[model samples]
Target: MRAELVVIGAGPAGLAASLAAAARGTRVVLVDAATETGGQFYRQPAAGLRAGRPEALHHRWRTWERLRDGLAASSVRVLTDHHVWCVERTSVGFTVHALLGPEQEEPAEVHARAVLLATGGYEHVLPFPGWTLPGVVTAGGAQAMLKGALAVPGRRAVVAGTGPLLLPVATGLAAAGVEVVALVESTGPGRLARRGRALAGKLPEGAGYAARLLRHRVPVLARHTVVRAHGDDRLTGVTVAALDTDGRVRPGTERQLPCDTLAVGHGMLPHTDLAEGLGCGLDGLAVAVDAEQRTDVPGVWAAGESTGIGGAALALAEGHIAGCSAAAHLRGTAPGPAPAALKARTRLRRSAAALDAAYAPPAHWPEQVTDDTVVCRCEAVTAGAVRDALGLGAGDERTVKLLTRAGMGWCQGRMCQAAVAGLTGCPPTPSRRPLARPVPLGVLARQHTQEELS
Candidate 1:
């Protein structure tokens, strides 16, 4: 397939970018791994479910409908079920490599003159004892299951973590008829009050979730952190303790809550593999972008969570500016300023920063990790192994990974990097894989043979 511009990911950012570019007369192709258009935020229940009130699962349903309708009305070509693995620059433009089937064994390529990467983000998992147990899942994972499949993870649940995400997950579970025993938040409510001016815009949404939790009769245990998850084969309960002003757990405040499931998450990190692989600069773990949302690399732009962990509104603002810039550049014209979008972007970025500062995970949470606790779920590497690696003079994530195989698993550190970094007293580093995702050796060999024959 060929296009003037290709937007990867069908989330809010990608969807908005594709439509904006197409509306400006640019031939656009939108690609995504999911069969449905909405990203995690607007995740839809399966078609087989025949959900009577699909809108019940989302907060931004109306905004999603607008984007969906706009896409249907635009000239943008959308390719669903295409899991893009890598994109390479060519003399003419670029080539996007993807797997086109359920097995993801078949290679498919799309050529475009310009590319927009809005590949979205994933939950940030912080490990404590029994984190790898069967019934433990990320807060986002549990939300996705309910929103996309009309399924609940377990009958009895405890949603534990810091950040605004816990509120929605707790309410969502309660609405889904689960027995939510408690909502354990590590941050103190006083911190949120301190940021009232910055968080003022979010009060309405927060209040709604709070009201839902109140109506559901679920207890909100603020200033608390999970010490350990209990049960041998699965999570049957979790022990939580209150935190002091200095970020230490207060003595004698420990309590055990029984539940069949634990949905835990601290926050999120950007999906920067493709951006880093393309040699684009990064601002911390996020892909670095300019005012136009253009990456350091020419002919490439990135928006959404790939840029940072701001929510859908910020993604849309950034996507609009990026799409406008890419379309103008392709037309051999100077990109005009998107004043409205820029203003929204500026405001939302501040709100996002406030969220980061106010909802930061408790500092003492890592102290709860026991030697028996697994840090890297993929390699089954324990915290003890990571500590041992540190004792072996490993001072960074790379050395620890090399010594303990902590990040050598299939996920390639996406799930465990932060915990590993925290354990080793090193910062998380950017990963620049040769390919965006792993491919079967047979596929690479066949491509090699084809190249030789050509």
Candidate 2:
């Protein structure tokens, strides 16, 4: 496949970017790993499900409808189920290496003159005792199940986390007829109140979720954290504890809540694997972009959660700006102003920053992790192993990985890096891997032969 521009995601940002660029005369190809266009935020049910009211699963249904209908009517090519593993810089521009469909073995490629990365983000779930139980899932994973499959994780659920995501997940599960036992948030109300000025725009949306929670009669437990999950084979319950002003668990405030499901997530982190592979600069953990969302690398741009962990609105604004800039650059013309998008970007960014500040996980959370708790699920490495590695002079995550094999698993540290960093008292650092995902050796060998022949 070939195109003047390739947008690597079908989420809100990629959808908006592709439409914007196509409208400006750019031949764009929008690629995604999923079978559908909407990313996690606007995840849709499968066609086979024949959902009677898919829009009911989402809040911004009208916005999603517009994006979906716009793509269907646009000239841009849409390629779903293409799992991109690597992107190589070619003499002309770039070659996107991908695996076809769910099998993800057959190799495919898309050649493009320019690339936009809207790769999105993933949930950051800190490890707790019994978290590896079958019924314990990340808050996003639970939401994805309801949104994508029209299924609930369990009938009785405890949505425990310190982020804005918990509200929707709790209410959605409750509305789906699940008994939401409680919404346990580690962050206190005082923190959010302190950021009132910055989060003013989010008041209405928060209020709406609050109303839903109230309607569902779901108890809200603020300034609380899930200390541990309890189960023999699957999640049966969880121990909740109150947190002090300093983000430490208060003694004598621990209580056990009986629930079949524990949906927990501290927050999210940007998906920068592809950007790091492309040698793009990073502002801390996320991809670095200029005001127009263009990366430092020529012919490459990034928006949405790949650039930062903002919400859908910020991603849309950044995507529009990026698309307009990329189109103008390709057409050898000055970019036209996008005043409305620019304004939204500024305001939404402020709200995102405020949310980030207010919803931080408890500072002393690691203290609650039992020594035997498994931090790295893929390798089954325990917290004790990581602590032992620290005793062996492993001062950082890389050294801990080398000693304890904590991050040398299938995910290559994506899931366990934050946990390992917390256990080691080190900041999580950027990991640069040549391939964005695990590729079959056979596929690599075949690609090598083809490149040599070329």
Candidate 3:
């Protein structure tokens, strides 16, 4: 496939960008890995599921409806179930290499004059004891199951995490007929109160979740953390403990909460694999983009959570700006995004910063991990093994991975990088992987042969 602009993601950002660019007379191709248009924020239940009221599971339903209807009426071509593995720079433009569907064996490519990356972000699930158990799902995973599958994780559950995401997960599960035991938050109320002014716009949304929690009669355990999960084969319960002012577990304050499911997450990190593969620089852990959402690369732009983890509102604003900029550049006109979008971006970014400061994970989280606890589930590397590497003069994440193979598994450290950094007291570094996802050897060989023939 070929187009003037390619928007890589079907989420709020990509959808907005595609619509904007298409309206401005630019040929746009919107690509995504899912079977449908909406990204995780607006994930839809399969048509076979016959969902009666899917809107009940999500917020901003009217906005989603507008985007959905606009997509159906637009000229932009939509390609779903295309799992992009890499993007290569060509003399003419760029070639996006992808695999098809769940099988991920067939090769496909999209050539475009310019690329806009709205790849979104992934949940950060810091490991603890019994975390690898079947019922111990990430908070986002539970939400995904509920939204995409119309299914709950378990009858009884505890939503434990230190981010804004935990609020909705706790209430959503409870509303879905699950018995929510409690909502455990490691950060105290005082932290949020400190940033009250900056997060004023989010107060209404926070109040809504708070009202839902009140309606469900779920207990809110503030300044508490899940020290360990107790289970044999699956999750039966988790041990919760109070955190002191210093973010340490208070001695003798541990309590066991019996529940069938433990939905836990610390935070989220941006998905920058494609951007990094294309040699785009990053600001901290997210892709670096200018006010117009253009990257340092000449023909590349980025927006949404791939740029940083703000909510859907910021993403939409950024996407609109990027689309306008790209369309103007392509058509030899001046960029003219709506002033409202520019204002929204500035306001939402400030609120996002406040939320990040208020929802940081507990400082002494790694101290609670027992020696036998597995840090890297894919590699089955234990905390003891990482500590042994530390004893052998491994002072960094790279050295520790080299010594114990903690990050050499299928995920290539996506799940364990944060935990390893916490354990080693070193900051996590971005992995400059060539391919965003693993490709089949046969498909790669075929691609090589095709290149030679051409």
lDDT accuracy of residue 360 in candidate 1: 82
Q: Model-by-model lDDT, in order?
A: 0.90, 0.93, 0.93
Q: Which residue pairs clash in candidate 1?
A: none
| lDDT tens digits by residue: candidate 2, 8-119 | 9989999989999999999999999999999989999999999999988898899999999999999999999999999889999999999998889999999999999999
Q: Where's the lowest-lDDT run of ten residues in candidate 3?
A: 329-338
Ranking of models by TM-score: 2, 3, 1
What candidate 3 gets wrong by more than 4 Å, as runs, is none
Mind sharing the TM-score for model 1? 0.98
Error in Å for residue 368 of model 2: 0.6
> On residues 112-136, what C-alpha lDDT tens digit does candidate 1 reach at each position?
9999999999899899888888999
RMSD of each: 1.1, 0.6, 0.8
Clashes counted in candidate 2 amount to 0
